[model samples]
Target: MTPTDLPVLTIDGDRVDDLESFTREFSTFLDDHTWRGNLDAFNDILRGGFGTPEGGFVLRWVNSDRSRQTLGWDATIRWYEENLKVCHPDNRADVRARLDRARKHEGTTLFDWLVDIIRIHGPGGRESEDRVHLDLR
Candidate 1:
């Protein structure tokens, strides 16, 4: 199925009451699809969302910039750290390396990476204009 044919996971930044609530909602959404609440699971889902028949999905973020400040930076970093702790030792190094790279990338936040990844892998490949739709307004 095409990326547009898949379901869209909408995150309303304005409605995020707190981190706990956002976490709970996000986790619940992931759980509904049998996601394991880890980077691997997240990556798998992304892969599936991008034309993989097994995983088809889309993501829409409203007020994404605000969400970045409210639930993007620290929360995503903490998630990476927490998931890394539970990951296999062999994989930890690679995960850490990626995390380090992500940190070093100027002006590129986790959310930005996520959106880019989706665009690169989805439908029209890297040049696909239908990237993760973010409503900054």
Candidate 2:
């Protein structure tokens, strides 16, 4: 995707605070390893939260599959797992369920939500359209 097509989000401070707190707690859920698929824990860390901060959140996905397939996938997955501090689910339902929960949660922080955005859009291995001015509010 071109720079013009990149997506941007408004992540405010209040939202950032909630996400930071969640990240800290979520970090406790992971093992000190190089790689692991932990998406559920990550979702749990942000579900049912709210964003009070003033800034926006931006979501970007860089596809290195052609250049580094394993590395890209591993890095993306690891980032998601580590950020959310949760394990990946076996089916789409489980993943969706977790996201539903997090969205339901009140007062989601910015940092945490940013992680969520990344996780949701991380798959497919192809460059995506730049999504800007998405209404997160």
Candidate 3:
């Protein structure tokens, strides 16, 4: 189907500064947007069937410039720290490594991570059939 035929589901970056607010923005589309509050859950949600359409759709993130700044390093560091606190014992080392890298600003920021996750369901990604395009504005 043409891109125009698909629905446009928007998330205001102005409403998303971290994972908490990030998931909360979904209330605009879902009756209960309360979520697992993690990257894995975010990825799963993009797969559709919750409240989002099962077919192709556009996830337009408006005010994305502001979101990039808000969901950047600071949010990444905080997420990693939280993961370290609750992640499986065997995963502690990896979480620590990521936290260290985040502290050093040596890897992808949280914003990049979110974009990557959403894009993975788009045209050429691993789950391309889902056709969940991310329109970052």
Q: Which candidate has the top score in TM-score?
A: 3
Runs with alpha carbons beyond 4 Å of true place in candidate 3: 31-33
**TM values, all candidates:** 0.50, 0.21, 0.91
Q: How many pairs of residues collide in model 3?
A: 0
Q: Write the per-residue lDDT of candidate 3 for residues 50-103, one digit (tens) a residue.
A: 778868788889999999999888989998998899999999999999999999
Query: In candidate 2, what are the lDDT values of residues 1-137, reduced to their tens digit?
Result: 32333334323323222333334433433346211224454433222222311221233222212213322333334343454545444555654554455455433333344444444533331211212222223
The lowest-lDDT stretch of 10 consecutive residues in candidate 1 is: 127-136
Return whichever of 1 and 3 wins on lDDT. 3
Could you give candidate 1's per-residue lDDT for residues 27-89 as a string of tens digits? Answer: 555533654334445555555443423444455667766766765656556656776998899
- Quote the lDDT for 41 in model 1: 50
> What TM-score number comes out for model 2?
0.21
Instruction: Report the poorest 10 consecutive residues by lDDT, candidate 2.
Output: 125-134
The residue-level lDDT of candidate 3 at 49 comes to 67
Top model number, lDDT:
3
Q: Quantify how close model 1 is to the true structure by its C-alpha RMSD in Å.
A: 5.9
**Which whole-number lDDT from 0 to 100 does residue 22 have in model 2?**
30
